[model samples]
Target: MFEEDYKRRFVFGSDYGTSDYKYGPITLGERPAVIENRGYLPERSMVSKILGVEKDIVVGKDVAYFLESGADLSSRMIYPMRDGVVAKSDPTAWRVIKELTKFSLEEFKPSGFGFKGYYIVASLSAIAPRYMYENLINIYDEISRETGLIHASTIIPQPLAVAIAHKELSCVVVESGHGNTQVAPISRAPIRDAIVALNRGGSEANAITAEVLKDSGYGDLAKEESLVRRVKENLGLLPLNLDEAINYAKRNPEHVRAIYQVPGTRIKIDLAEYSWTRFLIGEYVFDPNHEIFQSYFKRGMPRPSDTRVGDITFYGMLDMAETIIRAVERCPVELQPHLYSHIILSGGNFMWRPVSTMKGIAVDSQTKLQHMLRDKGLENVNVRLSPEPQYAVWRGCIVYGYAIPANYRWEWEKMEGWVYHTK
Candidate 1:
């Protein structure tokens, strides 16, 4: 009783996503605290001396201040995960991950009596290698030894965490983040052999938005990725059909016209005459191989290329519908319908809203996915976005850590259960 109660009070969850890190204790309730999953290594200078900055690396919210202070940010800043996987040789990436972990644990470290350490449940991308698991666990172990802030720790795949949080024991989870998308089928546990991944994601959409900005005479703003991404989230549209939406926008330009004023700034972007290009952003994200995109390619937009990382190949050109089909078909033939019927889209990339006036021309991600799947001849398909998609993985981690017993030791073959930091 005491052990379970202790866990209930101190179960901690950490989601190491590509763009942001979600972390907190189980008590965080609905959403975990988030910080950009990045780190800045400050260059030694007089300016650094004046700011009273002593640490070699900066993580969490203070990183923004350090970033704004320098122009050499591209060289100094590091994003640990690329397409959801981190390379072992990149010491900078490891440093960022380690610092972020330590910072998060320390931020919420309990000082009360009878508090031993947190039972941490951290999630990684589905395609992460054994070495990543080992490396991460080693970090936790080291942190536990030094700070005594971790009772035990374990790692689970992001898709499984999504499935667990969504309470879908037998379904497909299509997790899309900034750099890549993953389609993994789950039947209690993740079906490792059935996982399918795409090299396309939100970044691809941002790329198109940048091109559109250039074409719309906002050429100067096109160079700023953050600004372009903001322009995209505000002005982008997910069309039911690219051709149909473009035709409607061209005929009734006022209906789709969008202008986004950058927050806390004098800058405002108006995609006036080029409003028809809005559909291209979402269309390209879902299906980049459409014939119309060839012109963009010719105009110097980089194609999302197929890249092989470790033993997996992330298909860049596969349409969302085909990607789901490929992943579901890899599972047991009898289970295909079960997986198809309960498709769950989980991630920030799927966070889209429909315009009521546009009606049939524009739609939310869920409706767009259903249309695409229907076109692919998959009947009785029901697609829904994961509730609180941004924090689903972290919430799942909290639940997982709370349930697993302290006595069931961590095992390499099963890849579940706790690695006891203190006996």
Candidate 2:
């Protein structure tokens, strides 16, 4: 009872996503603390020395204080994970990750009786290599020894964590973020060998949005990535049928037309006559092979090309349904049906909702994926958008840490269990 009570209070969950990091202790309830997964390295000033400001790297929202103007800020800011894997030799990236971890731990460090340290469960990308695991564990070890903020730590795949959060042990988890998408089958544990990697995600949606902006005479604004993303999120509509939705938008211009006012600024982007281009953003994410996209490709908008990462080949052009099908088929024949019956979509990339005004023309990710799969003759398909997709991984981490026995030592072969002892 004592162990269970202690675990419930002290277990910490960290989700290191491509665009953001969500972290907190078990007591945080449903949501976790989020910060852009980037860090800023500040150049020491003489005034800072006099003030006794000694930290080398600044993380989370506090990075705003150390940020430089224009070009310098961009150069100093480091985003550790691109395709969910950090390069082994990027010392600066590693330092940022370490600082971010320590920063979060320290921020929530409990102060009271019987509180020695936290037992942390961190969720990483499914395709993260052995070196990533090693480096992360080493960082945790160093932090534990130095600060006594971590009692034990373990890393689980983001997809598996999603499955745990949703309580779907025998399911397929499609985790999409800014840089890439990972479709992994989880029977009892994540079937790493059967994972399907995709080099397309929210960035792909943003790419099409930029093109739409350029074609619609917002060429100057299209150059800004952040503005492009905001435009994509607000105006992008996932269509039931790409061609059908395009026709609907072209006809009922008033209903589908988008006017997004940049928050806190007078800038309002109105896709007046070019509102039909909105469907292009969502369609490009699901299936970019449509001939309409060829014009954009011809016009010098770089296509999402296939890339190889270790043993996995992240496909660029394959539709989402095809990608999921390919991943599920890699598993045993008997489990395929079970896997198909419970499909969970988790992450910021899958958060788009269908507009009520668009009706049959636009559909959410769940409906769109279901239609795409049913068209391919997989009748047993069931897809669900994870609840509060942003918090799923972190919640799973908390549940994982709370349930696992403390005596179970880290097993390198299976890559599950806790590290009671660290360097």
Candidate 3:
């Protein structure tokens, strides 16, 4: 049996990120977008964009900042949704969500549980347990009652929410997020039973690139991971003459690729570029033979049934593309037949195309991606890009908010020791 004191009647979906929070207010009727700046106080301009309210209602700093400044402190707190579903498991993360929720409630509608409807669109990982769901409901119930409203809540799988947000009935969703890279199989307006998550993601990609730069005689260039990312975004690509480029770097170690200016430091504006002679730094995405993957041999190759990453050098843009393709190949073949029609590439990683440059080559990450997907025999697969790939999960939650039925309700005691499933 579940405790009534811990139940919320409505479902709300949220996609929390490192820099911002994307969520939707879900009820029986209309669903509205809810965006918040969890990183810092949002500017008035940003709040105006999301709330769609007159500037007079939201004068200056974002809701949380304004509330913390003592404008009106009685408002109850809302839970801060995080990037991955389980991020809240961190103690520090819980506190952050608490503060962010308070900010959310202060600016918009006053949150409460007494309301007739409430449902949650959370990551599938978030709803894995009955007790976890119950605790989340209890938190919301307290928040609602403190603000003088009734509590009602339910949850939607995050991958399913993302699919809904993308409006794709059949596709392979590859989310290269800040914390983790997750690939889920979906079809016919629903997620398939097969899904995979890897410890690697954008953060790891950046870290690895940074580490490579530091170790390869470009120590000064290595620390600027963010700048390296910007350069990668603007200039990274799969070189057409992959072999020549590899040979070139090995020969002319002094050739400069790009120059970047580091702000507010005595460090002179640094010219950052990779030369063929210098041993490629962060080029593993292009070269399958890069030394990084060589460690897999020492650890022993994974059994075919095991999904472990192999060495893939950044020899060209194809390296990044191969990761996605390889992951797809690893999926249970029986789960996704040849009929799957789409491969929805989401995340900031797929943002550019490879183009030729004056000094050297530029690898278009996207072109390599498309070519690899086609070559992998999923020719029926069409590449679908999620608008604002970073926020797709959040948008999915917003979409899920609108989809809940008016009669939907979450009765915890009725679901004793049972794993509940709904759509």
TM-score of each: 0.97, 0.95, 0.60
**lDDT, residue 363, model 2:** 86
TM-score of 2: 0.95
* Candidate 1 local distance difference test against the native: 0.89
Q: Write the per-residue lDDT of candidate 2 for residues 159-231, one digit (tens) a residue.
A: 9899999998799999999889999999888988899999998888999999999888999888766789999
Q: What digit string (tens of lDDT, one per residue) describes model 1 on residues 1-423?
A: 888888878999999998889999998898999998989888788888987898888999888777763357668888888877778999889889989999999999877688899999999999888999999999898899989999889999999999989988999999998889999999999999999999988889999999999898989888776687788888889999888999999999999998889989999888899999999988988998879899999998899889887788899899999999999999889999989999999988888779999998988898999999999888989999987889999988988888888677889999988888887
In model 1, which range of ten residues has the least summed lDDT?
Answer: 65-74
In candidate 1 the C-alpha lDDT for residue 182 amounts to 95
Clashes of each: 0, 0, 53
lDDT (C-alpha, whole model) for all candidates: 0.89, 0.90, 0.46
The better-scoring model by TM-score among 2 and 3 is 2
RMSD versus native structure for model 1: 1.4
Q: What global local distance difference test value does model 2 have?
A: 0.90
Badly placed stretches (over 4 Å) of model 2 are 43-55, 421-423
In candidate 2, the residue pairs with backbone N, CA or C atoms under 3 Å apart (3 or more residues apart, or in different chains) clash, namely none
User: Mind sharing the TM-score for model 1?
Assistant: 0.97
Residue 32, model 2, lDDT = 97
lDDT of 3 at 17: 49
Point out where model 3 deviates above 4 Å: 1-13, 18-20, 24-89, 110-120, 123-138, 148-153, 189-192, 212-256, 262-289, 292-340, 356-365, 374-378, 411-423
